[model samples]
Each structure stands twice: as structure tokens, then as C-alpha cells.
Target: MPEENYDFMMPNVNFFGPGVVKKVGERAKMLNMKKVLIVTDTFLRDLDNGPVKQAESSLLKADIAYVIFSGVEPNPKIRNVKEGKKAYIDNHCDSIITIGGGSAHDCGKGIGIVLSNGDDLPALAGIETLENPLPPLMAINTTAGTASEITRHTVITNEKTHLKFVVVSWRNVPLVSFNDPLLMLDIPTALTAATGMDALTHCVESYVSVNRNPITDAQAIQGIKLISKYLRRAVANGHDVEARTNMAYASILAGMAFNNADLGYVHAMAHQLGGQYDAPHGVCCAVLMPTVEKWNIISNPERFSDIAELLGENIAGLSVMEAADKSVEAMIRISEDVGIPTNIKSLGALPEDFDKMAENALKDGNAFSNPRIGNKEDIINLYQQAYKA
Candidate 1:
């Protein structure tokens, strides 16, 4: 076995709590940003009361002006970043304040990187490819999943190519990360569940990734434990602050883990679905989790067995292999309880597209970390299984 070690990347500053959303302006001032590009989706920006409202109040209090670019879509695209960058340049914005989930943060990251380096977004598509520092960016996460607010990795969907390219660079990690559970209280139950499952996927995938380390293992295990305990409760009742808070913390933990340990095939395939049909990223992850892990368990039965126990599977009389099988079973139960759609056919992805999707998935940066090294045939099989699941 190859020795596992990693150099972790983290946000410059982190703030967590119910009212931390009101502190964005203070942090913006600390970063000496005069004007900011406020990147968010139309839904958030249009909310009468939410993170966007709270952020605006804070920015006004701190005397920091901003330009709102509210065109970011559900599965954010390269065009969204380009438009945001245009808004930033035209409005003379000095920095960025990203609000919402991964879509908003990923769009802001692309804009910030392009703004600073003067390079095309496609040019910075790979690991550490950025040559210049990105403009200061602070991310306020309204959802308890994605963790795009803190991670050094950004996923930008190319409109023309239909590929969600992974951009890894420490320079693009948020200068400040804020997670306020109160912002998540109003989210619909389905969304809460989907996002929670996404966080769970991060922990599970990173725990068995090729880059897993002692530090990542500690975080991933704890994150799995937290998600297993609270995900159902949170989905059952969005008003449960305690469940929301725990999931938020778990998201951060998983983000910390995967930021260094990286992800696996689940994300690679999920990204392809997201890029192809603009499907909800978390829902895709939730639907694919069990199918991918069943095949993946053979790579590291011990780790998968641990995941089974962490997810509340009883393993008193089972072998590690049997317990590992329990992990996939547990994921399926949770998916049903949380209302993660069993089939992804709604996304218009068909069996015929599996081969092409698999070809693209094999090239994803996340695939390199998968415990099981697979070819296009293996990926196609996973896709077929997930589609019918």
C-alpha cells in the first residue's frame, strides 16, 4: 500500500454561529475591501429576509458598497463567472462576497481568479495552475453542505464543453468563511436533505481517497458520525436548530478533510451529471452514493466497514466485508428517509449516454483519488446502476 500523507489547505479565517451573517461587513473592512461584487442566485438576492438581507445590512453598516450579480444558476456555469467578472470590472469592485451554496461560491471563485490573474477561466482548470493571487473573497454559506465556502477547490461548469472542470489552488480559498445555521432554517426539507447527503458523501469519499491521511481520517470519521446522527432529524424538521448546526459543523469537518484528502468517483460522475443537465449536485451525489460505494468497498473493506458502524449499522456478528456491505445499505435507507430521488432519469441522462459520460468521468480530477482505479467500462457500469437506482 502507498503511504498516505497530505498538505491541508484551509480558509484564512472562519466564523460560525447563528448571527455571524451580520459580521461579514466587519471582515470585509478588515480585508480592506472598498467595493465588492456580491455573487448570489436570484432566489437568494430576492429573498425578503435571509442571508442576503443580513449581508446587505452588515455591508451598509460597515460602509462597504457592493454590486449585486444575481445570475448564478443552480449548477453554476462558466458564463455565470464571466458575467460576474464583468459586473465586478464595470462596477469597479475591489473584492467579492459570495452568498448561498456551492453555485454562488464557485461562481465567485471563478470571477475572483480571473479578475486578479487576468487569465482565462479555462487556463486555470487544473491543480495549482493559477499564477497569481485571486482577489480577496469572503464566502457566506447558507446551506450546510457543499462546503464551497471553505475549500480550496472550485468546480466550474464549461458551457460550451459541458464539463465541470476542477480548479485546485490555495489562492482561491475564501479569505473568510462564515457558516450561520439560522440562514438555513427556511430551506425546503428536500433541499436540506439533498445538501446533507452531499456533505455525507464528502466525508465517506475522502475517508477512502488515495490522499487520505491521519488528520483527514479523524475529521471524516467525526463528520460521518455527525451526519449519521443528525441528517434524518434535520430533514424531518428544518426548524431544528441543533440538527442544522451539527450538519453545518459536519460540513466544515468534511470540507477540511476532503480539501486535503480529495474526493472519488462519486464526485466525478456527479459532476458530469451536473454539467450535462444542470442537475442538482447534491441530489446526484445522494442518488449515486450506494451504487458507487458497493463497487468501491472491495478496495478498502476496513474503511468501508468503519463507515458502516459510523452510519449506525449493527455489525456485532459480521465480518469486515459483511459490515462493509452494510455501509451501502445504510446509505440507501437514509436516502429514502431523506427523500433523495431513487432515479436520476429526470435529468434526461439515459443509458445510451453512459459511455460518453464515463469517458469524461475518467478524466475528472476527483477520479485519481478513488480507491478503485477503473476504466471507462467500470464507470459506465456505475452510471447504469445509478440510473436505474
Candidate 2:
């Protein structure tokens, strides 16, 4: 076999700890950003004493002008991107500061893409479609999932087609990313569980991806171990500083893994459900993860076995195939422990729509790196299995 070359990408700089969001203004100033657009969801924008407010205070202290664009919706849509771009243009903002989770970060990236390139969001769906450099973007993460803050990929939904497409480019990576655990201390229990599971899915899919290399494998393994140890703690007590800090690190580690090595069918299929149902992205990924991985275990049993152990499964004395099966069981167990929905059907996904969703999943950028090259039928079967699981 020949050696394969791979590329690893992440934000140029990352800050992690408590209250590190205070650096946002100073960082923007250092970047020579005159006026900035703050992209976030309405809830965060209005939350008292929230990270958004902390960021605003920082920007004010640095004498930077900013306009808030709080139209970011869950599973960020094309219209959200368009609205954010308009806000940036209207406010004459020179940079972007995305506050919140993946939706806000993804919407900011989309807005930057259109501002630098063209307005055809759908036309920019494939990998590296970006020809021009994006504006200076800073991501302040308030949640411990998605890792969109550090990743070079953004998932955006096209309202017209009702499909979520990924745009992958090193240019999409933020200039800086902040992962302050304090911001995550107030996240709801359900959200914490969903995001933790999402991070775990990233680790698993990237570890088994055909594109996986030593670097990504190490990150994915570490992320899986951390999520297994701390996710439940964080969900049980949102204010658990230790759990929140570790989960934040886990999220970024998984981001670094998948942002480079890429992801598999779990993310590919989950994106379809998000686009169609406007369902929570993390929850969709959590529900579909085990089913997809069950199908993928045949592609790389050793990797699945590794995941089984990393997820704290007792795989000792088991055959390779048996240990790999443990990985699937562990995933299901974690989802159940975290109170995630038992099946996609509970999340409002319709079996009748599985055909189109599977078709779209095949075309997702993440699908190319999937360990198993599943056909449309294979994807539909996995969806059905998850529907009943």
C-alpha cells in the first residue's frame, strides 16, 4: 500500500479557560477591525449577563463598534446567512464575531463567504468553493459542541431544496476561537447532553474515516475518552466547572480531528434530518450515530474496538468483532443515559422522506470520507434502523 497525504486545519489561535471571552475585543482591535458584526441567536443576544454582553463590554472598552445580528436560527439556513450579510453590509462592519454555538458560527462564516465571494450560497456548497479570503472572524463558543468555532467546515441549509450542504475550506477557519467554560455553565441539561454526544460522534466518525491519519486518530481518541468521562457529569450539573472545561477541550479536539480527517455517514445523514425537520443538529447526530457506526464497523473493526474502550466499554477478553460491536452498544447506552430521543421518529423524521434525505446525504461533502461507501439503499436502511432503534 502507498502512503496517503493529509492536511490538518484549525483556527490560527484558540483560547480556553474561564472568562477568556474578555479577550474578544482586544483581539478584534489587534486584527484592525473597525466595526464588527456580532452573529448570534436571539436568546443569547437578549440574555442578561451572558457571554454576548461580556463580548459587547469588551468591544466597547476597546472602542470597537459592533452591530448585533441575532437572526441565526438552529440548523442555520440560507436566509439567516443572507440576513447576517445584509447586517454586516448595512452596518459597514469590517469583521465578524460569532457568539453562541454552531448555528451562529456557521451563519457568520456563510455571511463572510458571500461578502467576499458572491451571494450564491447554494453554488458554494462543495469543498473549497471559496476563491477569496473571508473577513476577520472570531468565534466565541458558548456551547461545547459543533466546534464550528475552530473548524473549516460550515453546514448550511438551503431553504429552497430543504437540504443541508457543507462548505469546506481552510479559509472558513476562524482567525481566533474562544472556549470559555463560564459561558457554557448556563447551558440547559438537554443541550449539554446533545452537544456532548455530537462531539463523541465527531470523534468516532473521524477515527474510522478513510482519511484518518495519526494526528486525527490521536485527537479523536482523546476526545472520545474525555466525552465518556465528563459528558454525563456536565449534563447532570451544568455548573460543574471541571466537566465543562473538559468537555470544551473535547469538542475542540473532535473538531480538529474531523475538520481535517473529515466525517462519515452519521454527520451526512444527520444533516439531512436537520435540513428537513429543522431538528436540533446535535440530537439528530446522537440518535443516528450508533446505527451508522454499526454499518461502518465492518470497514475498520480495530478502530471500532478502540472506540469501544475509549467510550469506557469493557472489551477485555472479547474477539475483535465482539469488541467492535461493543462500540455500538456503548453509543446507545450513552444516548439513553443522556436522555436523548430513542429514535429519529420521535424527532419528527418521516420514513416517507428517507428516500430524498438518503439521496442528499450521498452528495454531502462529508460523505466522501466515510469509511463505508454506502449506496442510497444502504443509507435508507441505516435511517430505518435508527428510526426503530
Candidate 3:
């Protein structure tokens, strides 16, 4: 067996808890940043009821100059990054602050990478392709999912090919992350459930990924437990601060796990679904996760057994394989309880596109880290199961 090297990387600074948004100005000042590009989405910029304004108020109160670029969309595309780059340069922004979910943070990272390296967007597609350091980035997470704030990976879609590319590097990890549960209090139940399940997928896939290590396993297992225990409470009542806080912690732990251990076929496949169908990334993962795990259990039943236990299933009397099967069942029950539809069809995915999505997923960076090596046939089967669900 090749000895595993356990090297874990996390953001240097994390300010978590309620009202952490107020600290952004002080933190930016400490970084010596005079002007910041506040990267967000249109929903957040509406300012009628958004976290961006709260962040903006903090910056303004501190006498910091900033520009708001709120054009990012779900499943952020290369175009979003390009436009954000233009905004950054035009505003002469010295730093980047992302206030939203994964899309906004990813757009910020993309802009920072392009700004620092002067590399054409297409050139920086693969893992570790970035050669230069990116500008300092502060990510203020409004959602309890995606955890893009602390991750070194960014997913950006190519509009022409409809392919989602993953970029990984230590340089891409945000300099600081502010995770305030207060920002998530008003999120609708459906969005809450979808994003919470996304966090669960991260923990499950990272725990069983081929790249798993001791550190990641520990974090992933703990994250899974937290999500299982609290996801429903948060989904049932979005105003439950304790549930929200637990979900927030789970998001960070899951991010820490997957950030280093990497993800599996669920993410690899869902990226394609998101890019091609313009679907919610979390919904795609929620729909595909069970099918992919069922296929993966054959490769490592013991790991799945661990997942079962983490999900609060009684597996003591069962064999590892049976316990692993129980884990899949538990995932299905939780997903359904949270109102996630059982299949890709529920999300309007066409069956005819399965072949193309499978092919793209096979070529995804996350596919390389799955516990089981799947061919196109296996991928198709997983898609079919998800489609039929």
C-alpha cells in the first residue's frame, strides 16, 4: 500500500457566528486593502432584503471604498468571471469580497485568479494550473452550503462546450471567511434543504473518496453526523438558530474534508447536469447521490457502514454490506423528508441528454477521486437510476 500523506489546508482566518459581517471592514483594513470589489448576485444586490447591503454598510462605515458587481448567476459561467474582471479593473479594486452563496464566491475567485495571473480564462482550466498568487479575497457566506469560502477549488462552466471545469490550488483559498448564521435566517425552506443536502453530499463523498486521509475522514464523519442530526430541524424551521449554527459548522467541516480529500462521482456528474440543464447544483447532487453511492458501495462497503453509523442508523447487528445499504436508505429518507425530488426528471433533465452528461462527468476532475472507477456504462446506469427516481 502506498503510504498516505495527510496534508490538510484551510483558510488562515475564519470569523464565524452571528453578526460577523460587521468585522469585514476591520479585517480588510488589516489586509491594507483600500478598495474592494464586492462580488455578488442580482438577488443580493436588490438590497431590499440582502446580506450584501449589510456588508456594504460595514465597509462604508469604516470609510472603505468599494464597488458592487452583482452579475453572477447560479452555476457561474466564464462570462460572469470575465465581466467581474472588467469591473475589478475598471473600479481599480485592490481586494475582493464575495457576499452570497457559492456562485458569488466562485465568481470572486475567478476574477482574482484572472487579475493576478493575467492568464486567459481558458488557459487556467485544469488542476493546479494557476502559476501566480491571487489577490486577497474575503468570502462572506450567506448560505449554509457550498462552503466555497474555505475551499481551494472553484467550478466554472464553459459556455461554448457546456463543460464545468474545476480549478484547484492553495492560492484560490480565500484569505478570510465570514460565516454568519444570521445571514441564513431568512432563506426559504426549500433552498435550505437543498443546500444542506449539498453539504451532506460533500461529507459522504469525501469520506469515501479515493483521496481520503485520516484528517479528512475525521472531519467528514463529524460533518455527516451534524448534518444528519440538524438538517431536518433547520429545514423544518429556518429560524432555528441552533440548527442553523450546526448546519454552518457542518458546511465548514464538509468543505474542509472535500477541499483536500476531493469529491466523488456525485459532484463530477452533478457539475455536468448543472452546466447542461441550468439546474440547481445542490438539487442535482441530491438526486444523483444515492444512485452513485449504491454503485460505489461495492468498492468499499466498510466506509459506507461508517456513514450509516454517522447518520444515526443502528448497524451493530448487521454485516458491513448490509449496513452500507442502510446508509443509502437513510440518505434517501433524509432527502425526501427535506422535499428533494427523487430524480433528475423532477428537475426537468431530459433522458436523451444522459449520454452527453455522463461523458462530461467522466472527464471531470472529481471523477478521478471516486472510490470506484466507472466507465461510461456505469455512469449511464447511475444516470438512469437518478432519472427514474
lDDT of each: 0.90, 0.92, 0.90
For model 1, residues 322-358, the per-residue Cα lDDT tens digits are 9999999999999899988887786678887788789
Among all windows of 10 consecutive residues in model 2, the one with the lowest summed lDDT is 1-10
Task: Give the alpha carbon lDDT tens digit for every residue of 339-367 in model 3.
Answer: 99899987888878889988988888799
Off by over 4 Å in 1: 1-5
Task: Assess every candidate by TM-score.
Answer: 0.97, 0.98, 0.97
Candidate 2 regions exceeding 4 Å error are 1-3
Q: How close is candidate 2 to the true structure, as a TM-score?
A: 0.98
Error of 3 at 31 (Å): 0.4
lDDT of 2 at 158: 89
Task: Please give me the total number of clashing residue pairs in predicted model 2.
Answer: 0
Q: How accurate is candidate 1 locally (lDDT)?
A: 0.90
Ranking by TM-score: 2, 1, 3
What C-alpha lDDT, on a 0 to 100 scale, does residue 68 get in candidate 2? 95
Provide the lowest-lDDT 10-residue window in model 3: 1-10
